[model samples]
Target: MNFFKKLFGKKTGSSNGANQGRANFSGVYSTEHFNERYNEFSLEKDMLDGCLKMIEGYFIDNQIERIIEGPVNHPANLDQVDQSGFGFVLYCQAFELSEGEATMFLAFAFSDYLITKYGFKLYKDQKPDHPLRGMTLKYDKDGVVLSLYPFEYTVKVLKGNETFSALEEKLKANLKELPKVDELLKNFGIGGDK
Candidate 1:
């Protein structure tokens, strides 16, 4: 019934084979497993889009700036809180949303933006004991893989110690470094050496 419940519910996928065309994978994980992972992503795409629309509605209703830039540091926005909903105190105060709702809203909205703007893919890592065992964003560029936890970044910013603009800027800087690494490999004849 709650918004967070809808956005963060169990992963679901169709039985029809939906992973037949994927080719961007760069990890050691089997292609079969990667394809399996994609099934869930495919199913969640529409739901995530709907969630974004809901956030957009909230933005318009509240007259809050739709752009993702601002300080998240209010006195009550401490990182220390219940695991179920943490670091959303500032958002709750500013937007008049509950901790759980704010957490889900910010996580989905920002993560979706990063994925769309930067070509990252939604990934659900099912490996036990892995660092990225839950929802993650992954970018694979010519065998170079970058795994990101945008939700974790969101949580940190919402703790009132950082700003969303700073996070976006940091990501932009880091993305610039990836191409340099690729150029270095090209100069070394990584592809031609063989």
Candidate 2:
């Protein structure tokens, strides 16, 4: 619809630069290679939306509050991270998921939501000389970019031996403040073009 038109209207950033990795070109961020990757991502739009809906339904079914109460077009900020929020952790623990399962699922759902709704695109750095070698990167045309796993440090909150109340206390009292998503990218030498 109109959204797709606006999103794909003009590709910018370091997309067409030769120094960028050549393979797996998604038209949103790169152009040297074929845009098959972009095509795949475009085609998966429905699946991503469906997954969001499924998560919403699961929460409703369990009588927990909806993580996303409205349209998914919110700003992509760390303070607004829904998947790994307190309610989400409770849901995961309620289902008796292991720490690995909870973290992976939270990360995937968070990534999917960001891509489908927030205009972010995925890029993997495969070049040997790149500092972000082998990292899955995410960015928007507005120059917000970062490692895909921004919650890497936050996941340590999920110690397998802790009780839910104890985990909550640790998360609230012990964990230091998380950096903003763009700040996190800066730490990895990624963004700051603003």
Candidate 3:
């Protein structure tokens, strides 16, 4: 409880590239970074829950080993995103279906496999404790857009022209480096944040 008090005591700050998002100093920001401020609570509960369930099912069926949840708190950005580094920092409850038949959701932040400043070294335990890169995925009638929240360290390195092909290539590279989802299913078996 004391640890929670200390952590919730102060306000954390972050920035967007072209504009600045707002944050309240109150511990109400205790959820994921973009969750509370982004009005994630307004999403239709049943549909959002269904989508989340479907996404997880899709991962299980397709053998993709990616984090399927949002950040537990506000997170910073990572400089060198290696193979295992995960960055979609979003709120799980953040989702919507537009009148135009589009969808949007805040993504989760942080990764379990974050290395120290030296990317050469590896973390001993695969724990999702580190606060790293974060962004939101908006699904419109046209397509999906990954809006990365700009941080001093991450935006410059991660945002390279921000084209469709570039985004595809980066995602491909990241997925290729991850462990096989089937293998993780056999081993980790949803053993709390693999």
Candidate 4:
């Protein structure tokens, strides 16, 4: 038998044919669906890691106290993208912006890094009025807050959410747990003091 045919031909319920059953069910999920889900998951993971690295670099570089507590919250389905073939809309929030300068610099640095590193085009030039291009700094009864929206449509960092701080802290404490994120940070010159 030809190699192709032998490899995919009849299964004889043997040790080597264990995957044959899975092959039979492959048609149950279309290849496109599989690819979409996989891609969405990958994008979300990358985005989360990217955010962490950006914050870490900002903290280290500026000598600011690290407020990140845990892994970013995973992307969730949103109404706008629910039926748009997009899998999910992820949101992250960082807080305790008492260090205003560092927070502003970090947000801009992260935006620049995203554009240069990932080719994520900003909707417009960085300006206060630029819809997807500006940083918002606010002061409330509690403290200062900075909200950063890096991606035009998919990702955002909010303020005033309690869970956000907790998540950030968890991420910082468990930095070693996410190897892939660490690799990305190292590649981007984030983890090192330089």
Candidate 5:
């Protein structure tokens, strides 16, 4: 308890319900609001701690010996991607997943958030968007697996995608150079610097 207070600072009650609470995360979408969108409920504090711990293990397993947290970026949500939990985006050292390789960038949005707000449709039952549901991470999942494949269509109709593309190019080019975002990602144990 004392450790969490030191790390995440104080936890505050959320107005939504008596059982729910909001944890501070001003710089990123780590608030309980967004965190709840991904983790299973166990006590707001414990869920967060678990993420932190999991992140740490990932770092060691991946051999990111020195570097800690990575940067947090909120790229505009893609129409093709689920937006509900599109809240947390962490940029880290590149890692590979069973699904595929992610180039040091990941984003998360809540499957449950979509279901509760939009209706609890299975990831497959959704509509034209059904096929795209795989891009959105489900509750209790770890990092998001990023691939531009999900945005191929959305990138066309959406405005500013060109700018986003340019920014992305620059971001990819500078992934290791960005200090604070990298540091925060390190603290979160999301990934290590390359």
Candidate 6:
């Protein structure tokens, strides 16, 4: 009788294992990976809307002369291009005043805008940790230029008639007056400085 009972128990256990099979494997896999995928899906729409709204707001507040939507005409070599995935570009005058200073100012403004607007967390792995790792900034006798790609971000400063050296000097001299500039930008809601 005991042998029969034992044999029946063994049979039941094997049957259970066979029934479970791949069905049990489902819960064992992680759900965390799905979080990122879902988050990215949701963020795509949100980011695009946010970018358009921000651009419109900038134009209205700053009273900029012209504000064009979508891909507009730009000089091939003049302005910087930041290719954040949401389809946006920040076009401005490069060194309208030095190449180095214009480059520096653009970097600062872009970085500030990213952090404030998108809640982009900066990684502390580097001295100035932002998603902007491996970014490039270059200056020539003509002017300063930079380009960012891959749905990350970019800033293009257009060069006018000013020489790169003159623009650099102007940026350096204006450093002390940045606070006032900051206040002006704040008024325009550029970086949320207010």
lDDT of each: 0.47, 0.38, 0.26, 0.30, 0.29, 0.28
For all predicted structures, in order, the TM-scores are: 0.52, 0.37, 0.21, 0.21, 0.20, 0.22
Model 6: lDDT to the true structure: 0.28
Give the worst 10-residue stretch by lDDT in candidate 4. 1-10
Scored by lDDT, the top model is 1
Q: How well does candidate 2 match the true structure in TM-score terms?
A: 0.37
When summed lDDT is taken over every stretch of 10 residues in candidate 1, the lowest stretch is 1-10
Clash totals in order: 2, 0, 6, 12, 15, 7
Please, what are the lDDT tens digits per residue for candidate 5 over residues 1-194? 00111011245566665422222332344445343433322224454344334334444544443221321122332221212221112212232232111211221212222333323222221222334323332221122111122222223223323422243343343322323445556667767963
**Model 3, residue 109: C-alpha shift (Å):** 11
Residue 122, model 5: lDDT of: 24
Could you arrange the candidates by lDDT from highest to lowest? 1, 2, 4, 5, 6, 3
Least accurate 10 contiguous residues by lDDT in model 2: 1-10
Where model 1 places Cα greater than 4 Å from the true spot, the runs are 1-40, 43-46, 65-98, 128-133, 179-194
The TM-score that candidate 1 achieves is 0.52
- 38 Cα displacement, candidate 3 (Å): 11
The model with the greater TM-score, 4 or 6, is 6
lDDT per residue (tens digit) for residues 14-120 in model 6: 55555321111111112343223222211234544444454444344444433234322121111222222222223223214243333443343443333343233
Residue 147 Cα positional deviation in candidate 1, in Å, after optimal superposition: 1.2
lDDT at position 78, candidate 6: 13
Highest-TM-score candidate: 1
Model 5 CA lDDT for position 178: 29
